[model samples]
Target: MSNDVKPGRAAAIKSALESAFIALLASGVCLWFLISETQASDDGDPAKLTMLAIGLSAGLCAHFVYMAIAAKRAERNATLWVILMVVLMPFTSVVLGILLFNQVQEIEQQAREEGGAGSAA
Candidate 1:
């Protein structure tokens, strides 16, 4: 077999990135809904309130996903319930992504210190 290094990221990191991306999308959708609701209200539309609520919910869900990712990556000492609650919020997914990035940095530091530690047989 040829000695070719595999180009891949840790499974946990991939999951965290996925979660963060989804949350970002949700946040965008939520923002759009909020704007639409505001316009509807200006036009005296009865659906404005419902649209606003939808936007709020989307934002909340986004936050929770991020929090969940952080908790799974073992980078944060956040409580299960709190992480769940936060991850479900909008714009919070980005926060989780940032934290995960920080964790990766820490991992890199450890790897340097250990000098190729934990090599597979």
Candidate 2:
């Protein structure tokens, strides 16, 4: 399948980066909440527990970003992987952004080749 990003969609890169950073921050905040709860002599507050759970889960998702990066690097399953990540956790947008950045060199090479070929004709 073609790997070309649709032309004129630069905003997606920015969006992904923003999403990733948010996810990371949220996860960190949640961890802090959990720690505070623990320090509080097992307060048993559902609200704190809920935030802790969510934060830990989101943090787990950060590791999954490698899949997104690979899929995009392979240029075969960006949409599918990206969608899965997003549906599973909103923070995965950062993964997408990281993938995009990681793939830039390859993308630039392909563009140059295509451009040269077109010019040669």
Candidate 3:
């Protein structure tokens, strides 16, 4: 692969990781709001809580879609990644992102070494 393509793939994976992290953060905030509202004596504003829930869902969905696209671009199993992201949204994303990033780096390094050897010969 061209050096340019390698960076583009890496950037896409990084962007996906960022998206997942944002979604995970939003999930935490949403959970905190839910717990606080339940524990408080006074009723919390339903509209605000509803809006927060909606935003959290949207963030998660965006993360899933972005990650799937990134995985596909990286020649990884997009469907499997999406399923894992959906099933374990809060915990699995960062691990998978790191694995994918490392895999891409390894691939790039191997390609570079091979190309160098081929040209030298």
Best by TM-score: 3
Alpha-carbon RMSD, each predicted model: 7.4, 6.6, 4.0
Off by over 4 Å in 1: 1-9, 48-52, 80-96, 105-121
lDDT of 3 at 2: 34
TM-scores of all predicted structures: 0.52, 0.45, 0.70
- lDDT (Cα, tens digit) per residue for candidate 2, span 44-105: 78876887897678675763554454455445476786577768654555555565655654
The full ranking of all candidates by TM-score, starting with the best, is 3, 1, 2
Q: What lDDT would candidate 1 get against the real structure?
A: 0.57
> What C-alpha lDDT, on a 0 to 100 scale, does residue 37 get in candidate 2?
83
In Å, residue 12's CA in model 3 sits off its true spot by 2.0
lDDT of 3 by residue, 12-33 (tens): 7767766767776776787677
lDDT for residue 42 in candidate 1, whole number 0-100: 58
* Candidate 1 local lDDT, 22-59, one digit each (tens): 66577677677667667765564556667656766765
Estimate every model's Cα lDDT from 0 to 1: 0.57, 0.61, 0.73
How well does model 2 score by local distance difference test? 0.61
> What is residue 116's positional error in candidate 1, in angstroms?
6.5
Q: Which of the two, 1 or 2, has more TM-score?
A: 1
* TM-score for candidate 1: 0.52
